[model samples]
Target: MQLPDGLDVGLYPIEGFTNPEEQPEGNGFFITSRYARNGITFGDKYNRAKADSIQAQFSSLYYGNYELDVSSEEKTPVDFSAYKERVADSINFVIEVARKYEERDLKLLNKPMETKAEFNRKHEYILKDYPNAFVNYDYRGYTVYINSGKRLYHFWGRNAKDSGEKSQTTEMQVRKSEPEVLSLLNRFRPRKLYEVPTEQGFCLPYGFIAGDSGHEPRNIGITYRLQNHPDVTIFFQDLGMKPKAGKEDDLNEKDYVIWLWNWQYQWSAVSKELIKPKWRSIEMDGRKGVGTFVKSVYKDGGLNYGYVAYVQGDRQARNLKPDLLLYVMQDSRQARGNPPMDKDELEKLAEHIVSSIKRR
Candidate 1:
C-alpha cells in the first residue's frame, strides 16, 4: 500500500504477536492465526531471519518518518493501530508504575510521614498492653517510650527492623513539681538584719531602706551609749577588737573611743596617713541630736566607713536600755582577704539578730 509522504508502511508491523505470553501480559489479543495457535513456529533458521528482517525494515522506516516529522515541525498524533492499542497502553502503565515506585521510595528514604491518628492508635495499643509506657516525641524523627520498670525504647521505620528499639536504659526518678522548687526558694529568702561585731562595736543591722550612706546605707553600723549602764558595758566588751597599741589612753573618752573604734575597723587609707573626724549636730524641736563627721582618709582615698551616734528619746529609748543597750556597726570589708559571706548566709545571720533583738 502507498503510505503517506511523512509515514511508512514498514513502521506498521503485521498485526500479530511472536509470542502468545506477551499479549496476555498486557491483557490483550492479536488478530492473526499465528497468534491464536497453540505454538506456531515456521522453522528455527527461517523465523530468526524473518524476525531480523522485520526489525531492520521497521527501524529504517521509523527513523525516516521521525526525521521528516522533526524537520517539518509537524504535529502528528501517534498511531498505535498496527499493534493492539492495549500494548501501547500497557507500556504506559509500566512507566507510570515505575515513576510512582521511585517517588514513594524517595519519600520513605527521607522523613517518613507521622500522622497524629497513627500515633494515637499506636499509643492506645501500647497503653492496653503495657499500661505504663511514657510516650514522647522529639524533633529528630522518632517517638520515645519508657515503661515503669524497663528501659527507654523508640519506634522508627516501616517494619520490624525499624520498630521498638531500646535507645537508653536507666533507673528513673520522679520529677518534682514547680511548687516544690518554689518552697525551697522561699525557705532561702533574704533576712532583714545582719550583725558582725568581731571588730569591736562594729555591728550591722541591715535591711531594705532608701537613701544615701549619709542617711542610711543599705549596709551600715551604729554606735551608741546608755546612761546608768556600767554592767551593760560588759556585753559590748565581749566583742573582740584588734587593739591600737599606745592609743588606749587617747580613746578613754566615750566619744573618742567610739570614733577611734569605728575608724580602726571601718576606715581604709588609700594614699593618706589618717582619716580626720568631724562632728555635726542635728536639732528637732530645739532638742540637740549628734552625728559623726565622715570624709576620705586622703584627697584620693575613698570613704571606707562612717559612724553615727545619737541618744533615743524616752519612748524610743526603752528597748536598748536596761535589757540590751545595743549598737550595730557594718562595713563591706572582707576580713584579712577572706571572701565576703554569701547573701544566703548573711541573710540567715540577719534574721537571727533581728529575732534576738525583738525577744529582748
Candidate 2:
C-alpha cells in the first residue's frame, strides 16, 4: 500500500498488525490464535496478542532483548513457548502503555482537551479574585494558572516522568503559594537549550521551540525567539566531508559542506516544496560555510515565533543527510510551548530546515 511521503520504507516490514482479526497487513509476519474458549473471543485474543507483539518489537528496538531480560523481574526459561509468551506479554504491556500514551498525546494535541469555552467563563471567578491569574495549557497535558503577568501559579496533571507511562489523574496543584502571579513564573524553565553556530560570526542559544508529546521527550523543529538577532539552528548533521569546490568566498550559495557519504545518497530525497522563501545562506564562524533559513510566525496579532535552520560539517565519515534528518525532525518542535505553531508554520519550518542543506 502507498504510505505517507518521508515514512521510512524500511520500517514497513516492522509495522506489525493493526488489529488481531485481520491478517498482518504488511510485509511482517505475525501469529494469531483462533481458540474461542473460557469466554475468550478470537478477536479479543488476537488484539491482545498483536498489541503484545508490537510492544515486544518496540521493547526490542529500544531496550535490547538482553537489556529487557536483565531489567525484568520475572526470570523464566528461554524455551520456544516460554520465549514466545514472554515476548507476547511484553507486547501486551506495551499496547496497554500505548493506549494511555495516545490519550495523553491527544490531550497535548488539543490543549485543555475536555474543558471548552466554559473554561473562559468558569475561569472568570478565579480571575476576579486573582485578576492577573489566568489558565493556559501546560506542556500539552495539564492546566496551569498564571497570575499577575505571565507567572505560572498552579498546575494539574499526572507526573509521568519516572514512569514511562502516564500517571493516574491528580488534582490541581499550586506551582507556588503566592496569590501573586509573577512569583510563580520563575519556576518553569526551558527543558532543552540549543546553541546554533552560524557563518554570520555569532553563536546564539535558540530559545523555546516545540516538542512531541507522543514520542515522550523529543523536541521537533524547535522555534526560538530571535535574541537581539536572527540566527540559524541545525537540526540534522551528516558526518563525512566532501571535497571543497573552491575557496570559501568563491563557494556559490547553492554549494554546501556535506558528509561525503550522504552527498552520494541521502540528500537527494528530502522534499523542498514546503520550504519558505525567507530562507538564505550565511557564513559560519568566518571559516566554514553553512546554509541558513528563517520563518516568522504571528500569533495573537503579533509576530511571536521564528524558526532557524543551519548546517555544518566536520571532516569525518558518518551517516547524515538533510532528507533523512527531516524525516526524524518533522514534528519535534511542538514540545516547547502551548498554543503551538499552526500547521502552515510547521510546514514552512520543516521545508526550510530540509532545503537549507546543499551539495558541494
Candidate 3:
C-alpha cells in the first residue's frame, strides 16, 4: 500500500492545516516540518495539568503520545488596522483570563497573590516579532493567544499560575511560581493548534482528499485502500466511550468494539452478539492485541460487518485521551444496499493493514 502524502506520525507541539477553512477536502491534514510542533519532547521538563474546565479538558501537548483535538473556523477578512486592535485585545484577553484564574485560586487557598502581570506576558510573547512568522521554543515556553489575520491560535503550556511571581528559569511552572515535578495541576497550553486538546489531535490521509471527511470528530471520512481497492473503511475515534464497571480508566479492544457496536446500532433493536466472552488473538505493529470480527443483523434485518481491536501492550483507549486504538474496522452497515465484505477478504485486508502498521 502506498503511503499518503502526509502520514500523521504526530511529532509536534501544535499541528493542523495552515488554513483549514481554505484548504478544502483532505489537503489540510498534511503536516510538513513547517507545521510540526516538536516542542519539549516528553521527559522530565514535560508536564500536564488536571484539566478542570472545558478549555483545559480539550488540550493537546507533546508527552509520550500525540493526541490533539481538531477544529476549524472561518475568519472574517479584516484590514491590518482593525486586525492589530483585535490581536492586542486577544493578548489582553489571555492575560485577563490568566489573572482571573490565579485570583480565584488564591482566594480558594487563602494565599496572597498579585493578579497583575499582563505586561510581563507581552514581553514573554515578544509581540514585536509578530507580522513576521511563527515562534517556537523548547526553552522559555510562552502561552499566549494569537490572531494571525487568517487563523486563530491559542497556546498555554507550563505557565505561571500567579502572574506576580518571577522565574529565572525557563520551564514548566506550578500552582505558584516555582518549578516542581510533573503534575497535571499545571495546565498545558490553551495549548493546542487548530482545534484539538493538548493530547488528543488527529489528521487525515492525503489520499482521502477526494471525498473523505476532512476532520470531524465523529465518523471521520473514508479513503481509498489503494489504486485498485476502492474503499477500506476507517472508523476513527478520539475518546467518547466509557469502560464497563468503573474499575478501569480505559477500555480494551473487546470493550471498545462492543461500545461502538451498541452506540452505532443501538437503535436497531436486537440482542446483538459480540465476540466478547473471548476475543481472538491478533498482532499489530509487532504488538499483541485481542481482536474480533463478525457479521450481525439488526432487528430491522440490516446487515453489518465490523472488526474492532486495541493494541495489547500499548495504552488502551482512554475515556479522556487518545491512545493505541488499532482496529481496521471493516464495517459496511452504512449506505443502504451494500453487501457485507466477505470474511476471507476481510481477513486478508486486516492482515495487509496490520502488517503495514509501523512506528514512523
Q: Pick the candidate with the highest lDDT.
A: 3
Highest-scoring model, TM-score:
3
Off by over 4 Å in 1: 1-254, 257-263, 270-277, 282-289, 298-300, 312-360
Task: Put down candidate 2 lDDT per residue, 10-128, tens digits, no spaces.
Answer: 11111121112333222122233322211111112313344222212211111100010101111232133333343355345444444444456576675333334432222221111
Model 3 lDDT tens row, 194-289? 232323333332101121122222212222222122222433222323322331255555676566566643325455555453477765546676
Off by over 4 Å in 2: 1-281, 290-312, 315-360
All candidates: TM-score: 0.18, 0.20, 0.42
As a whole number from 0 to 100, the lDDT of residue 170 in candidate 3 is: 34
In angstroms, how far off is 65's CA in candidate 1?
A: 99
Deviation of model 3 at 274, angstroms: 3.3
Clashes of each: 6, 20, 29
Show the lowest summed lDDT stretch of 10 residues, model 3.
50-59
Candidate closer to the true structure by lDDT (higher is better), 1 or 2: 2
